[model samples]
Target chain A: MFGNIDRHTYITLSCVILEPNSPKISLARAGHMPFLVKQHGGVSVVTPRGLGIGLASAKIFDANLEEFSLELSVGDSCFLFTDGLSELQNPQSQDFGYEPMLDVLRSPASLSAQSIISEVMKSADSHAQGHPQHDDMTALAFIFKGTNKILSEYDSIPL
Target chain B: MNDVKFTIDHQSFGDVKLLKLQGYLDAHTAPHLESALGDLIQDGNHKIVVNFKELDYISSAGLGVFMVYIEDVRMTGGDIKLSEMKPKVFTVFDLLGFPMLFEIVEHDQIALSKFTA
Candidate 1:
């Protein structure tokens, strides 16, 4: 369905599905960076095999689309980002880079996943030195705080 | 501006020569290094050590420059070895799966020493 859309086309959509008995948080990527999983006081870069969203003809699975399970207990969070976050550069042409991103993740004030995303975006924006984005930037963060209310409030805080 | 800062100098470690780099290695400055290394390769100076004592960063594209010349240098019975990468840069190299591919060391003098040993 995505391949049919032209490159110049722009659309936004969102959906929610509640699967009560689904196995622990599962994510599968095709041609996408392995999303960042934050737990145990460490940031792990998750890289998956395959092409990005547009390459439908390319196989997303061999035998079956296996969802990589990440065990997320309460207080755990994950950040999914595109190339834009790391590619941003400052006036000096220095990349915002991964180290800074790690720093933001480790900051005490950045407790919630949404706060982490906001901090990451702000860091990228500031480091870009008022330069415009070179490409589309998108991030999705999921934080497990043991309940839905806490997660929703944390996710909705505007940047 | 390109972050890499280096002045051309020649040093002899036994029979090998070393060129030291002192800045970041990313898309912006990799071309300069590529050209320098290209010239050395053309001149048949295959035994080389790139001292990265001050290098703080590298991107995947920067890594490509070395990968492109690895086979050529080896075919000539010469090799390119890297040494003295700052921890930040080393982490990037490690993240990109380079430790398994390149000869990396922790000291500039020691890295140059590999060309002789």
Candidate 2:
């Protein structure tokens, strides 16, 4: 059905399905940027194989599409983003690049997904140096707190 | 206003069509590359090669152009092979996991040989 549409219209997308309290994650990619998975004291990029929508027929899409399953351990974090974040440029016309983004992920301060997102956005803004973003910047982070300790701590917070 | 210009030069090698892209490939310039691929597919020329040696940058929009036509070309018993990419340009494609979905060769001749093979 996608192939029948005009070629000029195309989009990249990524989807992740997770059930509450489940460690198994199902990830689907559609020509989107590779996501990062930080766990076990290391960061790895998950580049799942898939094609973009409206790019081909259902037959081709189904043949090439692959779903990835990941079992997250306690304290594992996953980061998803668009090209806009990595391609952000500074006054010197240099892109923010993946190294810095990875650095942020590797930081010890990245105790939670929210913290990681905040640090990355702050870094991007600083790198931009007042240059307006050329592309839409978006990112999503998921931190797996498998144990009840973290959940109970959240319950202790004042409402 | 950024003065970023993208150009695509088409060259034919037997059944293979080569598109040499230069300059940045963002949302603003993705349509140019998309149209080029569309024309090639329309002409019944499915075997294609895109040279990224001179391409300075490629955004998701630019990458989407490849996804747009790869399956159609493959269905027609043809393929869009990439070649001669600079490391910078290649990194973007690599980051997006294109190397898994597309045939990316180090040299143009290698890509050409694959078409003939």
Candidate 3:
């Protein structure tokens, strides 16, 4: 498959399939950052050992692929972001990094997924200190509020 | 935002070519890298080293450039050894597990030595 590309061209994907009225979701990743999960007042990352699609032979890519089923508790939140947030650099060339992003995820202002993204974006923007973003920065968050009310939001700052 | 800058400096040591990359490497700048590597491979110089000590950043697009040339060079009994990556630059590759596919060394000299050793 890679042969067709005059040069190496591949896609990085991180996907989660949701079920109706269920906390369980199917997840798959291809050369993407791990999903940031907020649970029990803490934050952690979940990533399977998967290489980017088209980066190697189908055999190798398939062998590395690992699909997972994750069940989140009602107050748990899941986030996936492009490197734009963590890779945000200040004038000094210091990146905002993941720790700060995790901090926001750990204790978002409110239970709403939008709040989670807003807090992180605000922090990331502050990290820039007037330095404009150079890459596409996208953030996604979903909160399993309950059987009826689920909050999710996607935000992006592209340059 | 301002335009991202990238440049490649190439030098040869025996059978291996060393390319020193500087500045940010993102989608807009990856083509330059593709051609730089493609040119070397076209010339039958497969053994190569990419020194990243000076590279400030690398997006997945830059990483994809490697996927394009790796198989070609390896088929000819040569390899691309990466070296001198900054912590941040390495993280981009590491997060995607590039270490498993490519040999990463601490210094450019270490990468060059591996070609002979």
What local distance difference test score does each model get?
A: 0.62, 0.80, 0.82
Rank by DockQ (best first): 3, 2, 1
Winner on DockQ (2 vs 3) = 3
Candidate 3 stretches with Cα past 4 Å from truth are A19-22, A146-159, B1-9, B27-32, B107-114
Predicted candidate 2 versus true structure: per-residue lDDT over A1-159, tens digit per residue: 475666556667898887665777788898788878887778888777886666556677678788988887888778888888988899898988777778888899987776788799999999999998888899888777884322313333357
> Residue-wise lDDT of candidate 1 within A34-143, one digit each (tens)?
46766667777664333233222224323223356666556666676665677677777676666767677667777777688889888888888787776567877666
What DockQ, between 0 and 1, does each candidate earn?
Answer: 0.03, 0.38, 0.50
DockQ metric, candidate 2:
0.38
Write the residue-wise lDDT of candidate 3 on A34-99 in tens digits: 888887677887877777766766887788788888777888888888877777889998888788
- Model 1 is docked with a DockQ of 0.03
* TM-score of chain B, candidates 1 onward in order: 0.84, 0.94, 0.95
Instruction: Kindly provide the TM-score of model 3 when superposed on the true structure, using C-alpha atoms.
Output: 0.81
Q: Which pairs of residues collide in model 3?
A: none
Considering only chain B, report the TM-score of model 3: 0.95
Instruction: Return the TM-scores of chain A for each candidate in numbered order.
Output: 0.70, 0.86, 0.87
Ranking by TM-score: 3, 2, 1
Question: What 10-residue stretch in candidate 2 chain B is worst by lDDT?
Answer: B92-101
> Share of real interface contacts recovered by each model?
0.00, 0.33, 0.53
Model 3: per-residue Cα lDDT at residue A137: 88
